[model samples]
Target: MKAADDSYVRVAVLVMLSLSLLAGICATLIHWLGPVHRPMDLIVPPVGSAIFGGLIVALWRRPWWLQGIVRLALVTAVLALVAPAWFYTLQAVSTPGVQLIVVLPPVSSLFVVLLVMVMIFIPGRLAFVLALLCWLLIALPVLAYLLLHPREAWTPRGIDLLMAYGPVSLIVVVLLPVQRGMAGTIRRLASERARMEVMLHRDPLTGIHNRRLGERVLRGVFDGARSAGVIMLDVDRFKAINDTHGHPIGDRVLQAVAERCKALLRADECISRWGGEEFLVIVPDIDAAGLHLVAERLQMAIARLPVAPVRQVTASFGATMIDGADSFDSVLQRVDRALYAAKEQGGNRVVLMPVRPAAAGALASG
Candidate 1:
């Protein structure tokens, strides 16, 4: 999650830097083409563009000082607007009969951009704190000047700038914490939902899929008319092991068996704890030969598994392939019968059951 957040921040920073560079180029172009050109426009835009370009390159390289660099860039952007507003305001004060509305820079709209950047890039209380500081630095002077010139403050442009810098900025800062709280709530709920889903589908003892999930997967296979191999496995003499070494040792044995079996299966395959000392495996897209081979491998793996304080551990496997016309119950019944046959045959062996003739007819008809 931290890596994802860092990635988001990097992308946002790059976008912001690119926009700043573009803004500088546009400002320079406007000054160059306009009938009246100012020395400050030529000097500031080119210099600021150079700074923005350098920051863009630095962000692309991604050094250890990237966080400090972002902070610096944000500060520079804010100052670019704030300095102009202050300068024009000071100039207006000195000149008599100067129409403040026409002469004053429209820096209030740009301040909104800086405020949004602060809110997005900065975290926790610091963001609001920075916002307050920004309001003070940018709005305070204009507000004081307006208060002094009451007639100008009541004008359309004056009122617009006043509301923008004052109430509008305040509302944005005040509502942000509430927005952050709601976002945090959403994240927590999503995380909790994922955890509950895991608990629902997973067996508590073996940390494998539960019977419910296994049945669901089997049902999906049947619904899709796909071929799959089902292996019903039972730990041989599980009750005897529990009686001799206690339930704790038996649990450990089950866990080890589950781990080993899971390791052997493909990512598309699933193994579930079907019941006590029993597991159900679903391997998709397998033929009868491949299914039998898989069952043999699982049997050998269990036979070779060494659980401490036990001489040896083994499991019996009953393997069968899906018939196209088989229902969930019918397939499970076939696997269960095969498992019973394996138990009867001295256990710890793979038993394969062929598809029923009626089911094969159903398949052929379909």
Candidate 2:
């Protein structure tokens, strides 16, 4: 489950447990204050209190058992509230001089609280179904009893209770499904946003960060005032491979080359498909020696494999340490020049841009 869903469960469990404690306390006060001796009423409060308290403790200690705990709490809360309302409605009807309208209306109001609780704690489809069942179990029985007793219908109180209990319950039942639909829409939108982010940043063919994301990372390295390096590599005679084999096999060659480079690089280093048949590698906290070593390793890894149908593959590399004063275009221009120099030297070799540390430092401070 997601962290948000886990948090929702925790909060729901806490709310139910707190309400159970409140109910238990109120029942205890009523039992002491009232003149009537109701043994069942007295028994319910402590039992409910124990169940809720134990559940709270169990959840606090072992939150991994949340699914089971939520299911248990939902069922327990429904039974605890529904049973009392049913028994209270029956008791109010049997006794003399008890106004059925006044008694049943208050008992029926409890369903409203139950409906809201289920909507908040449970997920959409299940919550609506549970709320509907509770309404049927509690509201239907009370409405039936009032309808059967003819004397109860003669009074204005009976009509008031009937309206509040019957039609009101039906209204909430209709609205809950609409709420569920809205929640489902929100979840789908969140999923779409995540998918769009991946598409924007990642290469579809190689499944690595693309040029746009690589440039953004490069800008961060420049801003941090740290020593870093960029290695620009182009597959030597790449067009020849595409000409010899089809584009499909050429694509496989690119994928194979990308996998080889990725396996050799450290966690902190990044390789991006710079453009057609060209790749750019970014390495942070590196000196000139380390940068050249990485470029050589990449060259060896790609040349080692057949890459199917193609007997051998080689890459020409151009590397330079990032200067503090360089902008994005300036850096690319310098690396491209070095790459041209390597290709001019007959390909499959590493060329490093000449460095002037003193001049670079002066420019950086200015």
Which candidate should be chosen as best, given lDDT against the real structure? 1
**What stretches of model 1 exceed 4 Å from their correct place?**
1-80, 105-107, 222-227, 285-288, 354-366
- Model 2: ten consecutive residues of lowest lDDT: 357-366
TM-score of structure candidate 2: 0.72
Candidate 2 per-residue lDDT over residues 177-224, each given as its tens digit? 677678779888988988898799988887777999889888888779
Q: Model 1: which residue pairs collide?
A: none
Error of 2 at 91 (Å): 2.2
lDDT of 1 by residue, 316-347 (tens): 87878898877788888988888888888888
TM-score of each: 0.73, 0.72
Top candidate, metric TM-score:
1
lDDT of 2 at 92: 72
- Relative to the true structure, how large is the alpha-carbon lDDT of every model? 0.84, 0.76
